[model samples]
Target: MSVTEYRQASAFGKRREPHTVIIARGDDIRHFTIRPWLAAFVGSVLAAMAIGYLLATSYLVLRDDLLGATAARQARMQQAYEDRISMLRAQVDRITSRQILDQQLVESKVSELLARQSQLTQRHGRIGPILDRVKGEAGGLPESAPLPASKPELRAANQPVIYADSSAASFWSKRPAPSGPETAADRADRLFVAINQSLRAIESEQMDGIGTLTENAFKTADEIASALEAAGLPVDIDTDDEAVGGPLLPIDAGMIFEARVRELDEALEKLETLKAIAKEMPIHNPAPGKPVTSSFGVRRDPIIKRPAMHAGIDFRAPTGTEIKSAGAGKVIKAGWNGGYGRMVEIDHGNGLTTRYAHMSRIRVSQGDTVDTGDVVGEAGSTGRSTGPHLHYEVRRNGTAIDPLRFLKAGKAIGKLL
Candidate 1:
């Protein structure tokens, strides 16, 4: 058993006093007095120990909860990081796919452009020769004026927005890289557009050439017809009575190039026929460097000294001077006829004839072919003439026509040829 009692402080000091303790074990009693300072010290030590024990208990109970919360926060952060990575990967894949598609489309367009260029080159090779021939026949100008040798190119458009990418190096190399404000795809598009423009230029030039040829050919034909009409000859090129027949099959109007080529060919053919006819017509002067002694129509006769209709022009040629045929023809009468002595009548085609009279000697016999400027006979005053002269007469369908008209037309025709 133990008993402890605390004595009050003294009235004078108002401070803590001593504490007495009694302990009895088996009737043995002992007493001990603790001083005021020692009692206060003991109480303070006990209070500090109680507070320390409570703080340790609180820390031990909350440690697991704190650790769990930190782990959860770390897990959320890792998941967020993974989601971000997945999004970035998808974006990269989409970009890559788009780039690939663009590259493929560009390649396809390039191939088509190349193929078209080859075809245009081949067309130029054929059209160049045709254009040369047309220019030669047109005498420098066709229709209105000369056409441009090469067609102009198409103009460019507004610039496109360029994007950034790592895979831009695999494209065209001729255009040095670090290209400003334009991507590889845009550059390729520009190249293809230029190529198409070049092809269109080629097509335009070809069409222009065809049109020029057609115009010139028609003009030539018209001029030739006019010449033949003025010279009292027929433009014997038959167009309406040609034997042409075919089934009315479907025609392709889209084939503009081929259509133009065909049109040019037809015009050239018509012009050629007119040219042939003009070539055969009598448009040449029979006597070179010989002055006209007598004009045709209502002239005083040189021998009779009376007014009479002169059917031909008389060229003052010396005796035995060479006389050439007026034009291409076949001789029908090479011997004498009536007062026109030593007459040689040539039957020119298309209901026409020429009379070369007053000749001393005939070189071409009947049924013999004679070309223009061919020496037909030697000149002498054998016909009804007073002096040594060559009488040249042109007759259309057995009717005497003026020879001056044919000679004048020949001068105009020489310019075109």
Candidate 2:
């Protein structure tokens, strides 16, 4: 067919035209066509569209799965946080309870200390005055005065709260697992440290107070001993020397201090004994009122014209005046003796002895125990005397000393005399 007639017929029949072209490159010529090219381009575009659609669908599905996983992780984190909060609240409650118990224990200790202080105050009447003197002295103390006690050392908080990551990525770290705030052993150790510190502080304060008291007591004893020595009583305050060449007679300040300390210890023991006895002893007087006329030691003897040694003092009273035991003792002698008519000698402990001479009648017999102020005899001048009087004498180890010393030391001379 002719080209014009074929093209017209193909156009009229609605069929596409097929064309071929020849291209020359260098020495070679290549033939190219259009109908097969269109077919190949269309097939490639469809394949590309299908591949892109598949990729888009896979991406959407994967994104949806990731969102759901993220939501689940958030829920788990919330739950874990709630659990940690609950655990922290429990730990706080435990800590609070322990703090309350510690406070109660501290209050109990404070109450005990206060009670002890009160008891000590009552036992030592001079303590108040001494404390006042000390305070006055302290008021003028230098600013650089030594501090004997200081604050205690406190330990740092070794344990701290730690939060755990719930994510699986970090679950297997080699570090140790988190523990609670504080364990029972930790609290016990802290409490023990606190108690030890408190005890040390108390000990320091007590030692300081005792040192001050001992110093003052020694000073007073020294003054008293000096006065007594000046009074020509042959008074020497000395401790038993153990060393061979130790001062045969120590009258120095050191010896005086040692003696004073020993006496103070003895006095404390005696005070305790006296407190016990005061609880049981009768408060009322059981003896008749016998008026005392003469005092102890170095008095004029009526029978002897010359100056003579009068061992005991005389109490001028009626013949029926009752004689009493001054303190608790056992009766040793209640019969007659030379120069003393109808005398009763009572032996109290601690080398103390009392004798009641010139009695009209004897109420207690020998080997009888009598308490303080117990009626032992009736007052009368039964011995070689001029008038009706009772002779009273106090002796230490069978040697006559001043009876007034005990009466004065007892601070109850008015009641007895």
Tell me the whole-model lDDT of each prediction, alpha carbons only: 0.74, 0.59
Best candidate per TM-score, number?
A: 1
Looking at model 1, which ten-residue stretch has the lowest summed lDDT? 160-169
RMSD, every candidate, angstroms: 8.7, 16.9
lDDT of 1 by residue, 32-149 (tens): 9988788778999999998988888877887778888899899999999999999999999999999999978888887887776666666566566665666566662344645446
TM-score of each: 0.69, 0.35
lDDT tens digits, residue span 154-259, model 2: 2233522122223422343453544878766556544544444444344445345445445444443443334333322233334355665755774963354345
| Candidate 2, superposed: residue stretches over 4 Å from native | 1-272, 276-291, 412-417
**TM-score of candidate 2 against the unseen true structure:** 0.35
User: Best-fitting candidate, measured by lDDT?
Assistant: 1
Q: Model 1 Cα displacement at 215 (Å)?
A: 2.4
